[model samples]
Target: MTLFEAERVEKVFPGVRALDGVNLSLEPGSVHALLGENGAGKSTLIKVITGLYRPDGGRLLLDGQQVSFGSPHESASAGIGVVHQERNLIPGFTVGENILLQQLPTSRGLVDRTAIRSEAARWLAELDLELDPDLPVTELSVAQAQLVEIAKALSIESRVLLLDEPTASITPSEAERLFRVVGKLKDQGCAVLFVSHKLEEVFEICDTVTVLRDGASVLEGGPLSDLTRDEVVDLMVGRVHEALVLPPRTVDTTAEPLLELSGLSTATGHDGVDLAVRPGEIVGLYGLVGAGRSELAKALLGLDRITAGEVRVRGAAVRIRNVRDALKNHKIGYVSENRKEEGVFLEQSVGRNIAVTVWDRLRAGIGRLPVLRYVPKRAEADLVSDYVEHLGIRIASPAQLAGTLSGGNQQKVSLAKWLAAQTEILIIDEPTVGIDVRTKDAFHTLIWDLAANGLAILLITSDLPEMITLADRVVVMRDHRVRGEVVNSRDYDTMSQRVIRLIHAEPAPAA
Candidate 1:
């Protein structure tokens, strides 16, 4: 039975038809996938279905009855729940409070604290999460927070559930756990809508898939088993995307290292780490979620205090006390993993955000009679326009807010900021997170292009395939310590197995 259906839905925004004649049907006990490239109306359809937006045409039907939801709350009250990609939890609230916020148990006209905690615990346990109910939401890691969000959504016991990029921030094990929970929900006859950029995950979890492209349904609902991955990709992007293969390394390995960390110990628990990236080399730091990959990146960027270690740039020792020092003195750039929080300023224009790092160079005059220093608008515009074109950033205009752009475009802006800074050594953390496959391929090409142009890049990521596809060398880390390093043979199976063994603390098999 069709539990929910969207009939000829149409949504229009200023100067953009976000969704045009989009139709969908969600049957009970099935996971329906919504697949598309970035800015292809997937989000618009989700908003329309979840009551964040009302369709301009057609109607929504639930259990064969016409219904209209005025707001998200109204939809939720009608047994619809959503787990957004971006976390929507109150940081200061406890786990129990956050999970039971919508419908807290009451005793004598008062919020029942014990009952709430117990109920929250049960829900979390159902998802195989063993978190403390009293723990604050802010104290949890990104993966944990995601799990809590899932628990919160599941706590409502809704018949129709919507999960947007649920596994984007989680580790493989955690993602498996989520898949199991989703399976349980499906077994219970719950209708699930799964949206993801990862095609492998979509194939693993979805029963049926609908592909949207350019605000229209290019491929209507069909069993995923009936379609090939290439066909799905073609429908999503309107073109066949070639498989990403790591190009031959052209870096001079004999040259002095651009950035080297020797016996690095950070106050944040990173200990005795050693790594190096020479000019024209892309070194990948491969690790699991808690393997200290991000922490090491922070230590290199001076965002976290390094208790003991020697950081060398071109064989010269330097103390990077802060991010500014790392950028200005050592010529090191960092693209943070948490792009939404640490990367581009969301409210600022795309041009301004890209030009921010080069403000000193943008100044027209320095050391003048009155010490006049003014930003040359023409020069800034030229530079921003060059990067915008070179990086293929999709934006209406340079004056548009960075937040208004799609995920892939925002990431390009972040890269443009560092490129404008002209840093010699770049530390990019999870550059492709939340980006579509086509954009990911473009980024991989761009990274190699930058490396070919003699830029040293330290790529920090939890994605093994991405590591193999771009890095010349892979440094495996586990528990804040460097396990081992391997040269990429471009063989995914061998490289992944070695990395997995190292991550699991298994001794490398005798050669």
Candidate 2:
């Protein structure tokens, strides 16, 4: 029997049919995986189920009984809980308080702190988690906070738990712990709805699978015994393009290194990292989550402090104390991993967002009009228009708000932000993350195009295929150190094995 069901669910927003006639079902005590790219309506479906948004037309049933959830609170009371990708914990509060927030055990008119701690401890112990109930949430690591969120969800005694990309930020060991937790939850007859971009994890943990594409259910029901990864990838992408998208490497191969780091060490994950990239070269950094990939990029770009070693741009030793210094002197640009928070101003117009990085070139002074007084800079505006057209950004005009664009187009705008900055060295962290197959190709094309024009790029990503396809050389990082470097040769198996070893094998200490 179905534990939950949504039939012909529809959600309309302006010109978008966010969800159209989407149908789904969940069975008790089974794990269901929701599969989709960034803007595939999976998020909308989750919101509808959790009562964050009301569907325009649909029938929702819980345990064969017709039901409507007016609020998230109502959904929670009905044993539905969601652990958002972004942890919603209050840092100042203790773990116990965060777990049972607003519902602490209390007498008629008195608080009961002891009982709350005891209960929180019990919840943690259930998952074999070692956490101090009285410890402040702020002190917890990303992995620890994730465990606390899970314990909090289980505390609700939820019948259905929605985990959206729970493993995105955590390490492999932490992910194993979560998988074990999911197993335990299953043993207790709780239904789990898992959403992840990691296909391997989904196949390993989920008993049933549902694939949603463009706000509709395309495929459902999978033990996945006979499916290959390539088959799944094909289904996800739908069609292949015949375009020779990525431009060939055009920068003089004999040129000196554009950016070089020698024994660069930071207090964070980047410890004594050393690397270099020549002009018009794309060097790909690949590793698992927490492999110090993005951290290294940030340090070289001066977004993060480096406690030791030297960073140089074109053989010149530079003191890049902040982002502004990096941009002004080194012409360094960064596309952050967390796009929503660090990449773009979602509410701002496309033109304004693109113009932000190149404001110095556009303005006559720091706060004055352009050289052509009382006249709009038609040439600069035309550059923005050309970029939008080149990237195929789907918007009515440059005046359209960045937030209103699709996930792909928003990514394009983020790229535009940096491209317009006219930076020589570009640091892109997870450029194709959360983007669809079509969009991924477009992004791949854009990155190579930039490199073809003499841009030195440090491409930091977890996606191995992307690294292999786009990089001239691949650098492997493990245990916060550079493991080895290899030239790209379109060899999947050999490359995969080497990457795995780099991630799992112990590294020798630096001399």
Candidate topping TM-score = 1
Can you give the TM-score per candidate against the true fold? 0.94, 0.81
Instruction: Report clash pairs, candidate 2.
Output: none
Error of 1 at 452 (Å): 1.5
Residue-level lDDT of model 1, residues 293-313, one tens digit each, is 877888777778889989899
Off by over 4 Å in 2: 85-157, 170-176, 220-254, 269-271, 287-291, 364-381, 395-400, 404-408, 474-479, 483-490, 504-511
TM-score of 2: 0.81
Clashes of each: 0, 0
Per lDDT, the best of the predicted structures is 1
Model 2, CA-based lDDT: 0.79
Give each model's whole-structure lDDT: 0.87, 0.79
Model 1 bad stretches (over 4 Å):
106-113, 365-372
